[model samples]
Target: MELKNRHKKCINFDLDTKELLKYFPKGTRKPYALIKEFFEKQGFDHRQYSGYISKEPISDYKLTKIIHQLSIQYIWLKNCIKEFDVSNAPQTLSLKNQIYNSIEKEENKIYNQFIQKLRYYQSKKKILNSSTKIKYEKELLNLYQKLEKNHINLDEKSLKSMREIAKTKSLKR
Candidate 1:
């Protein structure tokens, strides 16, 4: 069977479903057949887009769960950046930006759901009362201060690499 088909209903199962199911009941299976049948009745997956499966159908609950997981991951990365020593500098910034970009590129609805949920939680719980928030903020402040200090950092490394490349080109000329 093809991994995906243009004419057949394209069932977009969670990419990580199999691994995630390990935490659930043994022999647990998602309602893949039900999803396919539902799409078939709706006349979906008839046309292809970009030579891949063209449609995505997911329940709001599942979408919320996926987004929540991603939000938690984003928060974790943010916390990591805060806790990371300034000596790590641009490497941490690069890593943080990579995570931020990945999260931003995800399905908009899912990302929005996450942001809403995060906001909801923040509203319900006072940031001042949350020890984790205080820790993250404090660490972030420290990191920012250290970053401002004279440090051989990521930008410097990139500049050095550029200079070396330019020197090599000049020698060739």
Candidate 2:
């Protein structure tokens, strides 16, 4: 693939960066096509272009891990590209910093709210004035234990009722 910076500086590598590289004139080049051609010379098939690759193939267990790794690689490559522009260096850095700061603020707000809820629950568990919280906790624990043992039949109606109760409790708060 040909990775070019805004300064017109370009670097070319094979599809896997392991094959032979033939330097071409800089103006216009199809990187994917070049890589495919290089692979063809190495007797490697292009799975996507050929009918050998199924459109929606069933993934085995090991393939799932491989796919996740490839997804991480794709994300990393995308991040690299987003920061690849050579011009307006200060503006690009400032934009990235602003985006990160906004994300951090949002995360902190959510974390604080979560901590508050946890503290409230902990205090309620300790107080136990009405005993209603104890009853609920006992029932929830029983249900959870049954679930862990695969003994509870979790039907839609029961799940819906539980969700409604949870929503009502949140609303009361």
Best of the candidates, lDDT: 2
TM per candidate comes to: 0.17, 0.25
Candidate 1 per-residue C-alpha lDDT over 1-173 given as tens digits, one digit per residue, 9 for 90 to 100: 23232122222323234543444335333333333444444433422211112244434344345435544633422322212110111111127787867755643434344344434434554545556644433443344334335242334543453345346446656
Model 2 Cα lDDT, one tens digit per residue, 90-134 = 111227788879976765554454344434545575576646664
> In model 1, which runs have C-alpha deviations exceeding 4 angstroms?
1-13, 18-29, 45-173
Regions of model 2 farther than 4 Å from truth:
1-20, 24-93, 126-173
For all candidates, the clash counts are 0, 0
TM-score, predicted candidate 1 vs. hidden true structure: 0.17
> In model 1, which range of ten residues has the least summed lDDT?
84-93
